[model samples]
Target: MSELYDDFKSIVLNKTPLIDVRAPVEFKKGAFLNSVNLPIMNDEERHEVGICYKNRGNAKAIELGHSLVSGYIKEQRIQAWSDFIDANPDALLYCFRGGQRSKISQEWLAERGKEIVRLKGGYKAFRSYLLRELEESTLHFKPIILGGRTGSGKTIELKKMSNAIDLEGLANHRGSSFGQKITPQTSQINFENNLTYELIQKLHDGFEHLVLEDEGRHIGNVFMPESFISLMAEAPLVILETPIEHRIEITLNEYVIEAQKMYECAGFENVLEAWQESIQSAMNRIKRRLGNQKHSEVCNIFEDAVQEQKKNGSYDKYRDWVEYLLREYYDPMYDYQIQKRSEKIVFRGNASEVHEYIKSVTLFSGRLK
Candidate 1:
């Protein structure tokens, strides 16, 4: 069992197949990386058991749980377990707390002379291990921060670099309110697992330099790990600069098409409502600062610019407006947080130039490092 325990940890680190015996809702909320849920109790059954535990007692809850799983359901669950064992002979299995449920399931399998290893402390244990690793792991690679203004093609450059860790891309966000993503973001736990996997991959590949886009502590709804952020703040930076027209073109490619598609899917009125709602607080701040007429004019200009961008396929008119909002709202806030962080600025005139510079530096240093 001790040897098997070590083997289980190795398999988890390697992201091998495993069975999670928690309820589906718990599994969906969060679980070990690459684990599949083979629930001991279905949603309603679990809820009923919980209610029984609260209303009655532990013994009554157990009795009700047994009553809920009749002959056919019990048979079905056993068959599922049998099928899983047949499919993965050495698979790791775990439940919520390494308690009666997991023990019962293991005993059931053992009666048939099948050997199944249970996680020592189950999901709770694994969660603790993961949290500790995230907090303490000595990440090897130095981040090459991709710094730029809102529309300056930093994300695209990171994508083009191919040796980059795109935090925003993985988070399915553009890193701002206006930076809504094309795809829905993953749960925060899932994002952390994904980020950890990417980081491990980079370290294992023996890469010494990793390019990454500069982002705030929170990208959309997901907050980055503090350890990684501290590392990023201390690493070298390359500040990209592109002409407003080029930046707008890049922004159009990255966001406009998707934004338009989302608007179309959501309908104009729905999108307008959402956009206005998202910007309302910021608009109020602007109103307080600039007064009613000026605030109204700026809002009108912003809406008109967006309409023009949609109609003309050019976001040039909104460039200054976007810059204004970023400088006034986003930059100052981010600066307040990371003002004294060490950085190196590398400016490029256009996307092509940015891409070229990154590729050249990465390729040249690849051999040396």
Candidate 2:
């Protein structure tokens, strides 16, 4: 027999590796940082059980679940659990609630001479807690938003600030049409969990100022908390400026070499082919904004650039389209948006100058390294 624990603080703060007994589909929807799913019932069986519970009642659901997952299937599940416990002795197990599924796993584990602890309120309770924690954290964060035109390397400057939170990085996105990562993005709940965790940690460390890059309400599919957005709107801003040539170099590195490294690391096959497909997809997403003729021209040039790379390893062919997109599309869009935000600007300079200004400012000074 294992103890049923309901200590949310310990469960969260310790971050013990979890043997999540939830069905694969449930796990995929949302999960914590250190979970290895070892479900007693697979997705289909879980679905059937859920339907039974809804229509036939809890007792009937239990009977149906037992019938569905018995004999060889039951033994296989217990064996898998045993294998994981053998490898991770400190691991805890939980399902939606510390109910039948988790309890049964515990009984089976005990039969195999292994002890397991279960979360009393399971994932639901903790997830509820996490949401509350996130909302409450907004009060403590004194956001200092980093505002700049595209390719000004706000992410670069953000890293230099000691109290910064990279929400884009947390979302595993670059926060733009072209910000796709080779690695799959985290589920919405998972993204929120990690983001909240980072914020709480910073607050606990006693950093009052939170620096963030200026972003829209949404980054890819991950939306910023409404509270955070309200905070950002009122935060002091530092706008970065760089020469056109410098912007071109920065954007080129991001879209090409740096992006390629991440793509390859994520196990993308035929990396060049992947890059071409991704580039085309990104361009298509912004087609309405780019307008028909300009969109067509950009796509044509992108295709030519891809062909050039495939031919003699010449990605220099991208320079024309990149420059055109910057001058005509991104620069104009940024200028229009920035014009509306004139009152928010507290400082404007290149990265080094901005860095110096941040160092000199009392609000951003003492904590920075």
**Residue 327, model 1: Cα distance from true site in angstroms:** 7.5
Question: Which prediction has the highest TM-score against the true structure?
Answer: 2
Which one wins on lDDT? 2
Task: State the lDDT at 361 in candidate 1.
Answer: 68
Q: Please report, in order, the local distance difference test score of every candidate based on alpha carbons.
A: 0.69, 0.83
Candidate 2: what lDDT?
A: 0.83
Tens-place lDDT per residue, model 2, 1-369, is 438876665555666778899999999999777788999999999999999999999999999999998999999999998888888887888899768889888888888888989888788877887788889988876677788878888998788777788888888889878888877787789888877777766776677777788988988888888888888888888999988887878888899778877778778878888877888899999899999999999989888888888899876987777787788789889889888888989999989988777667635523555
Q: Give the per-residue lDDT digits (tens) of candidate 1, residues 1-369.
A: 541253333654577667787789988887766777888789889999999999999999989877887678877886788788898787777888777677777877777677788887777776666676666544666677777766777776676665688888778788865666535676788777667666666655666677888886889889988898888767766767766566556555454455656766866766644554555555765566556775676677678776776688666666656555555655566555444553345543456766666666667555223
- Model 2 / residue 207 / CA error / Å: 1.5
TM-score of each: 0.71, 0.89
* Runs of candidate 2 exceeding 4 Å displacement: 10-12, 160-162, 261-270, 359-369
